[model samples]
Target chain A: MALKLYLDRMSQPSRAILTFCKVNGIEFEEVKIELAKLQNYSPEYAEVNPMKQVPAIVHGEFKLFESHAILIYLASAFSGVADHWYPADLQKRAKIHSVLDWHHSNLRRGSATYIFNTTIALAFGQPLNLEAAAEGEKILIASLAKIESFWLQDDGPFLLGNSQPSIADLSMACEVMQLEVVDTKDRDRILGPRKRILKWVEDTKNATAPYFEEIHSIIYPAKEKLQKLKTMAAKKEPQSTGEPA
Target chain B: MALKLYLDRMSQPSRAILTFCKVNGIEFEEVKIELAKLQNYSPEYAEVNPMKQVPAIVHGEFKLFESHAILIYLASAFSGVADHWYPADLQKRAKIHSVLDWHHSNLRRGSATYIFNTTIALAFGQPLNLEAAAEGEKILIASLAKIESFWLQDDGPFLLGNSQPSIADLSMACEVMQLEVVDTKDRDRILGPRKRILKWVEDTKNATAPYFEEIHSIIYPAKEKLQKLKTMAAKKEPQSTGEPA
Candidate 1:
């Protein structure tokens, strides 16, 4: 039986894993778990991953979740994966691991929270939290600054100055892709000054090619829907209740 | 040159790395980075870790940060470290990685945020954010429930039902140690129902032995100071500003 990949393209990590399998020529069956529809909360999906999050995998009798772990597993367990993605050298691998771990608490947290508060919250029937969005933006900007000044400081095009794209590169670039859902002006303001991050992300996307573009196609429509929601919210009249529309 | 571990015991991840080194008998020089004094923000420390975080390492010329990454590096690069800590098998290692990544977004986020909002925030000269503390507690409770039902479901005493403790176990148990600083009633309310988590933490502490206990000694004093602060705050009179005393 081939490896089974449970994912939802709407998720950044899910897209990373999907692109990883495609780029590496890893054989896997794609299983979509729709988060918007609450498919991830289903009991059957829970059996596959008790965590009930997408981008999980099952191979034979073994099961795993967490995109970083899945990417590492695919890179190590598969036959044809390039070495630079997850090198055998202890020092190089350690640096890559450092970037991956940093992404969870820093970049991922900021981007995900900012996008959710500014745009996705309304789609889920929640009000836009301007305060939380402001807080998230602070973290997001700091994280991007760190990426430009430190992670991308070396001459190499990828994070930690790796010449070739690692799983960290793919994972982070996909996370940055999430900013697309924000208003055009807001997204530009956040990413504008970080030239190195812009170039690095573009470089990573180009390096991965058509698969990267293909996997991220879902984000475009979501972005459009969010913009429309914002316009509609702006047009609403103020009521005596003084509640957010 | 000896391995240089830059750490501050007051930090949980720092303690995790320190304990791991002693347990594995990895020879190292401990360089204290006092977060309370803003030592992490110093230019000199930034040279070592641009992220300005504790639990960084400088091995010869290569520098690394993020405790999960450091632990992975130590387990693989060192000769005496046992395989159970980070196994050679692809699946076992992948499962371990899953837990470590999950720790950052879920367990670590919940515990650290809750503790900081409830206790450490005031120590840093910020007022207690009861709202943030309440939110953090919700996440913490859900995380504990997941750990009990899934990660510790197997017969084995440690996370993922491992007979031998892994890096994930040490990292997570150390994070739970942060809850010791919370109000005794609040701490018990959060953890008392999670019997499996309590046992697993004890098992992990015993497995790591004197090193775990020795590294965590700092938390006790910090806990006392916070309790005193809470007691003093309760005695303050109501003022027109309605500010938290």
Candidate 2:
């Protein structure tokens, strides 16, 4: 039986996994969820993933969530890939693992917050705060700097210096691509300070060319929604009930 | 060379990794850091891990973080243990991966809030609010319920139902043990009557055999300090603050 993937193009991990399958010639059924409306909230999807998050997979009787896991599973189980995506070497694999783990709390959180504050909060009719926005951006920049200087630089054109993409490279590129959707002009400016990183992201995009097709349509709607979100956010500064931390 | 671990036991992942090493009879160095004292904030530690989180390992200069990644790396690299710990079979491995990913947002955040609110808040003399306390309990029970009904069902005493525990069981057991330190005896009222859940928790602890040692000594002080933190909580209630979540 073929694998079943539950995804939304706007979701970074989903795009990454879809692209991986497409590029590798792996067979899977793609089920789309309307992330904008939180269609993931429906009872149907909930049975598959209790967390109601995207980038989940159902393979036969088994189920799995978390894009990183799904990425590894696809690469390992399918035929058209190389071992470099998730290396067999112990320490090398550990390095890849470390970055993926760090990516979750650091860059991944930053990307989600920036886009959500810029986009989803508007769709949800929630408020966004500039102070919080500025704070998140600061985190985003520091994190991006680490990705560039610490991991990608030593490897040359790709993360882990593959000259080919690894799961870390693929997973992260999808996240950085969220920033791309926010506003390519602003995205490059943010990425501008990191010379090698800016180049590496471009490299990852080309390597995962199939993603360009899956992701393009989602960009315009996302940006328009995000603009409306900005106005709603300006209106929201006063209602925060959180105690001063 | 023996494997070396750099950990702060205050962090549950570190404890989980340590427990895995001990259970496997893996000889390794235990290099401790005092998280309460803010020792991880040092610039030097930042060199090893840019994010500066604990439970990182330095095995012959192949430093790694992200407990799940470390778990897989150790299980794969060492090859000393049963395949069930991180099965070569894709389905079993995927199940473990799913739980590890779940652990990130679920265990990491919930446990941190509980431990921080009750212990760190006490140590720092910050206020802990009722709303926050309830929130923490909500997260813990929610996470525990998922572990019990989903992973620890009849066919399996362990996550995979083996003669011995797998890495999945150990990773989760570490977080569950945190309940001893930050266990809210009163949570049964707020999260609603989960008699089956409460009973399941006891069954889980009993099945594990060596439960208290998993959580003792470290949280004992934190538990002792909760009372004074309550006094601090009362004073700060006007402003809203208190012990660990």
Candidate 3:
């Protein structure tokens, strides 16, 4: 059976997976789950992923969720080369694993908040809070700087100097791309004031552009609308208690 | 050069790494980094890990951080057994990997906030937020429910059916043990709210008691002080940051 992928382009993880599969010449049917309409909470969709996070896969009898896991699973199931995609040698993979883990809590988590919060500001007619925006920018820069100094300093388009991008690039690229959906065209202003990240992000994105293109249409428009709706929802209920503010 | 494990016992991740090394008979010098005082911000440490979260290891020239990454690395490096510990098969390992990843964000994160806020509650004079105590109960129960429905049901005594515990058990055991440090011992209330989870926690701790001895010291003090300091801190800060009383 050909593999089936569940995705919503509005989600960065979904885009990363879509881009990766397309870029690597792996085949799959991409099924869109519309988040703007709350399709993720549908009983049918909930059976696939109770957490309702995106970029999951169904391969014959196998079911998988979590983008990092999906990225690795696809790479392994398709390519059969562990080399640097996720190195087979003990320590190199561990470093990749360590950075990947950090991406969620520190880099991705903080950056997502900055992007989402700015979108919130745009929707609500509120100016972006300088303090929160500044903090987010600092964290994004620090995280990117780490990637630059530790992994990308070899002066190549790819993160680890491999001709092709690794799962690390996939994870980071999805996050950085989400910044583009923010209301402001020049998001790096809030990301880092006069940031040094432009060079590395350009290189990383350019290297991974083919993958970026595969899922852009579905996710891009939905993400724009989600920002507008979020502001509306916030205005209706500022501290709606159970709803994530 | 022998493996050098860098840790601070106060951190649950550090303790998990320490416990895994001891249980597995892996030898290493303990390089303690004081996270409480923010030693992680130093430039030298930044050279070691840009993310700078703990349970980092310097194995000869190699450096690894993130407790889960370190655990997976140690399992692979020492050529440990496949059955009870980290397995090699694609699906089983992926399930385990996914849970550990979730734990980093959910259980571990909730507990970290619990520790910080409770410490704040103690330092600043205020009534312990019953809401915080409630939040603690909520996350832990949700974690237990997932384990019951997904990983464990009839397979008792441990997660993944190990006569001896795996790094999964070690990682979770460390975090769950910190629950004793959580200010609310309102077991009757929380258990009444979520009965199955209460039983699971009881059983998980009971099963791990054999190897759980070394960690009891750190856990006991933190938990004990949480209950002890609740009143002390309550005296310092006002309760209900929610609204003006």
Highest TM-score among the candidates is held by which one? 1
lDDT of 1 at B35: 82
Ranking by TM-score: 1, 2, 3
Q: Write the per-residue lDDT of candidate 3 for residues B1-245, one digit (tens) a residue.
A: 57988787877788878877766678889877777567877888876666676778888888878888888888888854345567777776776676677776677766655554545355334445545545654666676567556645455555644344567777876776555555465434333554544555455445545445665676666566556677655576665633336
Model 1 clashes, total count: 0
Q: Candidate 2's residue-wise lDDT over B83-160, tens digit each? A: 766788887777777777677667555765665665456555555555555556577767766665665567645664
> How many steric clashes between backbone atoms does each model show?
0, 11, 9
lDDT of candidate 1 over A1-245, digit per residue (tens): 56999998988999999999899888889998988788999999989988888889998888999999989998998888999999989999999999999999899999988898888876766667776777678888889988887888576888888889999999999999999889999989888877788888889889999899888888889889878887787677221121234
Per-chain TM-score of chain A in candidate 1 equals 0.93
Off by over 4 Å in 3: A80-82, A120-157, A160-164, A192-196, A217-245, B37-47, B120-141, B155-165, B184-209, B225-231, B239-245
lDDT of 1 by residue, B114-232 (tens): 88878886576556766677667888888888888888857688888889999999999999988988988998998888788888888888998988988888888989988887767
Itemize residue pairs with steric clashes in candidate 1: none
Question: Candidate 1 recovers what fraction of true contacts?
Answer: 0.95
Question: Local error of candidate 1 at A242, Å?
Answer: 14
Q: What is the TM-score of each candidate against the true structure?
A: 0.94, 0.84, 0.82
